[model samples]
Target: MSDRYELFLTCPKGLEGLLAEEATGLGLEETREHTSAIRGFAELETAYRLCLWSRLANRVLLVLKRFPMSNADDLYQGVLEVDWAEHLEPTGSLAVEFSGNGSGIDNTHFGALKVKDAIVDKLRTATGDRPSIDKMNPDLRIHLRLDRGEAILSLDLSGHSLHQRGYRLQQGAAPLKENLAAAILIRAGWPRIAAAGGALADPMCGVGTFLVEAAMIAADIAPNLKRERWGFSAWLGHVPALWKKLHAEALARAEAGLAKPPLWIRGYEADPRLIQPGRNNIERAGLSNWIKVYQGEVATFEPRPDQNQTGLVVCNPPYGERLGDEASLLYLYQNLGERLRQACMNWEAAVFTGAPDLGKRMGIRSHKQYAFWNGALPCKLLLIKVQPEQFVTGERRTPEQREREREQAALGQSEPEVDNKKVESNQAPAQIEQARLSEGGQMFANRLQKNLKLLGKWARREGVNCYRVYDADMPEYALAIDLYHDWVHVQEYAPPRSIDPEKAQARLFDALAAIPQALNVDKAKVIIKRRERQSGTKQYERQATQGRFTEVSEGGVKLLVNLTDYLDTGLFLDHRPLRLRIQREAAGKRFLNLYCYTATATVHAAKGGARSTTSVDLSKTYLDWARRNLSLNGFSDKNRLEQGDVMTWLAADREEYDLIFIDPPTFSNSKRMEGVFDVQRDHVELLDLAMARLAAGGVLYFSNNFRKFQLDEGLAARYVVEEISATTLDPDFARNSKIHRAWRLTAR
Candidate 1:
């Protein structure tokens, strides 16, 4: 009979029961449970089978010996008793992973050195040779764990932690360990649902850790079957024939599992770049046929099979601490709950988050909450059974919804888009004048429709998707409304309180209510911003955490516009004409963009066949957005997005560009800049600095939005300056000609 050896199985903390059950199922005998660890005694063959079939086991350790020691010398003496020649050859390479501190042995490195000295001395005396120490990628790995006054030395049968399945090639910011992901699935009751022939969906899937883990569970596939090597594979005591036999059994079971009917599983991720990585992982797992990953957002995610069918929706959305402030992410949790409560009747929902308070923001009453650990953070898994009766929303009911729709129509508020239909302003002129609306509301709606009519033709002809539709056109409704493709952005110019506050608010509400209907847009697609003179960077401060974006074209270049998360969308719609001018003159020229928010103008230059383009901005957030814009346009590495103070960069730059665009802020005392910048006070210095970098026969387009700005007469005469501010304004912005000023300067 083969001698039995004590085996220790270790896994992530909080998963002790699941690992213990797995060991028992694999025929392990005398299994004893501990927190985050399990101990059992079994024969070598049983151990081999456990290595091949146990999915939750992180490492299968064979306990070599246990001894009580008082200090380093006693540790060395006790370790020397083990036969050194029995395990590794004198010339073989070995590494020791020591953990914890013993009595009088406080440092792990010193303890490892002492153990090595003892083994080398015993082997050298007998064979005149000693094993070489290899700290990294060693042939044999030894482990020693020290308690109060005792130590247990063991062989780590699993070379590396089993969390690495050798399948995940791409990892996003914060990824869950594979074993921990599997444990979450088990804790969420996915196995029971899958056994009953239900499907699964993950809306906020990041690189698909949860989806891949869920697929493995639903398909009944072993997790580590793809692993090629284990520590025991090279050990002197390994039984090769027995391991190979169990490996073949695992393969047979996997093959049988693959033959079962397809499991209905789907994963949705908002970022398009991450979908490919998820596909690669699924393919590597041999479960591509069962899982489908889509590039989408949870806000618009409508899982398939809307009627009668029931399934589970599980996702690991970000907690407030890791990504940003907790308040910023509260809307995300609330939106997730609203999605589930509104659509997922009879379906079960599980939300796993590190911040328990964020879980409360989910809005649904969780029937059960399971405490788990994601790495070291205390997390909660909220389980909710979605039902129609559980929704506590502010949406109007059926009759009230219709009444509201009719009232909105009477007030000229936009309705949901009809199938292949739009509510254009050119529909009828006389009918709008005849509609019943509040006097101020009717006039506000009429002005909006008129501007859309005037700009629509020019916008279509110029291939512009974003333009200023109304720039403070009506005094009563002093607001600038811009149309970015299908979404509307409304910026209200704060009026003086001398104007009746109630009257101004009423007029503002009338305009807001009219925008969606008059422009054929959804109310949710409108982003409202209050424009006021700022003494600081509050103009660029973030407003919301939705981070929602849409694609809009300007001057034949596609750009991404974020409607939420900031006071200003990435693109400046009034600069549409200026961007087009740059594209017209950018061929074969080098381009520079200073104060380049999102670099939309730089993208136009690059698309216009500029030899090279450099975009400078002070914000890393905007720089990252600029990089994404360049990548979206398929620009090569020749384009660079630089983050720095524009003045400093201009002073340090020795390279010359054929064309440059400088659109500085009116006033910015940015902490990143060495000094404050005011366009009126520093225009000449900024202009001269830019002209110094202009190549021969080059012209610099200097522009700013400062309303009351005057040219520096001396500097203007120094260079041949041509004021082309008239041509820079399209018909839409003609009403507000003083909105911006542009000048073309060239060396005489």
Candidate 2:
């Protein structure tokens, strides 16, 4: 067994320091932070100890070779020159992993393929046999990272992404990435809090990542102890006896550290869906006895009896990515701030949010703010220091006390009084008119106002902006839209639960049929078109039959709508304000519409005086409809349509546009595309490609419906993101304000 080996410990961004500290604690030298990775030299026993103890790491890789490669041929030569048989047997299966930026080789799949070919070819020529390629459950997983022109290949010691700690039994719509969650906990200073006997609590703990991570740190449990296998176990150089000895030592260390009664760690969430996964994750971490998971709202939670000791309250609250409105979110934050100040006096609080403006509404000044990437979305973990000594020992008043003082100060102040007799004389007839408006159709308007108020109250208290509003008899075709300040959230509310899907469909169709009635347009001025949902085994087997309607004027103006369709008419009504913005801003400029489903905005761009428009979409059917939309808008000759892949096309195209609208599906996988397209994971690449074709001073309007969509922080340096969700919301959605987050990106 070697006393020294080059080790590359990998962690999610912002966690390299904690992992480095952990490595140092294990007697390994501190090394530099690479892109989502850390490099160090440690003994074989130290490597094993790291695998056992590191909480924030994703995987540990043992460096085998580092060589310069100017191009693909150089990459092949360098990989082939390495001694493959010494570590991996010819009969064993192998997998290649690729990462890093600014490489001559840009394509990860291509780079991985080249590396695999080089390894196999070298083994075949030398020993007349080669390892089989197994992407899933490979015996030996190799990592090839090309930074600039330098190629560094390593043997993956961890079999999977360190995030796969074997605890998650189920997941919600958008669960936190495990490694990222661990990084968040570490960033919030969990180790120090744990050592000081401060309790750790997650108010909105989905799947209990924070709770589990806190418990693991408190108990000194090795994060990877539950993992059944590692890539190194299959390596030829791996010594079973040495590995056994290291494992035994780790077990003894864990046992020795278990002397104290478990630290107080708990997680709470309102949704029942999160309970099973939360419990499963805690149990999987072997901290079930130490941590407890419960289903409840954050507003009503009471701190435990040990209030003398400082505690940490870390929460990842919903940013209205899926539901609710801005007004509600503001109120929610206000109430949340009040509750935290009132209920958790001695506890320090850290709230992680991708949206910063909403954090401002919490009214608590953050002591420290750390930036992190939540799968490409730039998120901030705001830490608020809440020391009881400040409240008890200071002459300064609490925020509540200040409010009381202000109210007392206002007691002596008075506004100018008007003559009530003269005011009544002037307003008597107006009051009767007001009574008439309130009694007639104004009754319905009053109901709408009252409903909005009730919905607003519920949305605020629930800490959500997106929700379903149950009401009937207003504009049945109208779906109220709201955009929360944080999370670029979009929420749509239809009539109450009494109106079933079929009834809603009928009402929607009637609304489409009556666009002329609602908007006071002629039937001849309206042209309706339908969009078929994409089909596959999943969609076809599910029998998901749905289509949208596009109404066009006889004079060539298009009005695409989903009046008769199920939930949302394909057209987002909240963006009515933004469509007007396009008309105002787009002038003599080339426009690009990505993920352009119905191309309504494309029409608006053309009408707004754009010189030309190029629309790219994977759906050929939608592209055809987009063309019709152009024709209806009398700008058929002013637009170009492409019917293939966006990612591939963007990579190959050299054309630049002055304005680009990128609104992709929340989640989708097309047959033509290589893999599923996740807005969070693929945003950086998509934005990079889009920006590559953007002219100087060009603006890109990027939007997504992933409700919990987070923008990647690393990409922020390249483009500026401004939240336009608030300006896009329509009046009907005032109750739950987050309709969609729209950003105007300008290249630096």
Candidate 3:
């Protein structure tokens, strides 16, 4: 009824700025931007055109009214004030969608019901009839958004979501929505490339989303050209003449564009299952002549266009969510980089990935980066120009210099700064092998290989999946490398203050460069941490928030290890022999573990058929981790986890145990404790409290990593104490005998 109406354009996060610019170009006036949404005013004709052409919007809504509300009654009254008769027929069907929560309408379902009731009541009184609810194909679709304390009611102009462009009914796992793909293409400057008659290719296209969107952009075809139904199609105030005029104009433009010479757009997918679905999507989009999808692997993907025309090479590579899945995907990203380097030279490349670190492994530097959100996961789009200068060779080269070198080679002249290199024309620049590793790196790699050769057999013969492969074996490279299943965890011992920081850094780089190549592990599987002397509870604090836990097997028990979150992984590798000893001797015995970090030993005891077990720790985080460890072994109900100061818990306990373990921290000043605990100053009193709970004939195993820890001589007078540190050493830890000091004690 009005000459202009308020419009709300909603899109995915991080695309608000782009949407605002696009809206302005679409003739939207008085524009305002918000998070994930843009608001503006537009005439009816402009609204129709926007719905037809907006490739970045998820939904286009026309606002009816904005009101203030403090409660559900206010919300109902606000809805009742609007004249529903003008928007919906009495016999028609409607759907009410409500978002946000405030003013006592905390539940979205209840909010929608209240709005629906207000509409129904008004319509029933006005015409003695009411509309029925139809969620899928509603004649009038209402949207109510509660922001702060205000209610904004609008009508949905675009039914369903704009991302569902009607062509991708069948798709592969984790397909990108059409609208998001279009946004990525625009960011990668695909339109500019297409204008120059360049070709387009997607090596890892899932379901041809990028291909379809790219073709549409290049051909100037409206994204929603084939949609038969719209939210406004059945509205009471529908303007059929204006809509028909716009629709006809769009159809003519699309037909004219299609008549032009088609662009060379292609997609290659490795999954055979996705090949037909991708082809079907292209066919449904009516761009089969402009786009073709072939079953191909990333390692062998080579797009040959007419006359060596190079366009944009875009892909949405799979970046897995799990810890184990990430390792294998490193090779996928590497292979993709290799293909781009070897096959698609002088092309513009755009890679959208949730894992930015893996994107860095592509061996090319992105000229520009754009951040976007794929649902809740943060993602990045890397724009790279596939030229020789962009390749990250050992020594970084400038574009001007590389171009000069190319010119010199063409003239059959000697080049500057030669490194006696053997270049494989087909290999990626990173794989050139000339600068693969430095002299120090090569020696370190040789040592790692030697260690693995010796340790691999011992690990298999002993059925060990977790073991220390290297521990400061070379004085120059002081890093402890341990293998947890297929993952590598490296800890760098802090260099002394007298050492030059730059030289130390160079050596560290050499060691890191050598690790993956020598061990045959992907670079993504390696987790590095700096090891320094920790004070108080510093060692227990989290170093990262990834919360990614990996599973490893040790002595027939499954254990969980957090490779990223904490300074130390949950399981202590040096304690392998002690845990196995507990498992071997825990049958029919009541076991107690004090100062239990993650309750790893308790899990071992439970697996060994302990009658009952009790574990005490001060940190709730570690106790929770311990519960998971116990539950993972199907021993949750039989085990007891006590969270408090071990000293306090032991003083309050009256139960006795047939076996006990005490592996206290070297120093802990947790706020949960009555006072600070120093292993040297408090060992006597701590052992006395633990011994009181030991039953007759019960055995106690005490161990600590405090290098200067000396067993109190008076304890030998009170009980029988035998130093068992040598016996607890496993083959992997045999080289480091002073790793921990252990003693077995029993009643005198």
On lDDT, the candidate that comes out on top is: 3
Q: Write the per-residue lDDT of candidate 2 for residues 63-170, one digit (tens) a residue.
A: 888998778888888999988878777777999998764546778888999999999987774556778999988989999887767888998888887787777766
Question: Once model 3 is optimally superposed onto the true structure by TM-score, how far is the C-alpha of residue 715 displaced, in angstroms?
Answer: 18
Evaluate residue 739 in candidate 3 and report its C-alpha lDDT on the 0 to 100 scale. 92
- Model 2 — which ten-residue stretch has the worst lDDT? 413-422
Candidate 3 ranges with C-alpha deviation above 4 Å: 101-105, 125-128, 305-307, 396-400, 406-516, 519-748
Candidate 3 per-residue lDDT, tens place, 411-510, comes to 4333222243545444434344325466797799899999999999999999998899999999889889999988999888889998997788668767
Distance from true position, residue 350, model 2, in Å?
Answer: 1.2
Q: What TM-score goes with each of the models?
A: 0.58, 0.54, 0.65
> Candidate 1 clashing pairs?
414-517
Q: How many clashes in each candidate?
A: 1, 34, 0
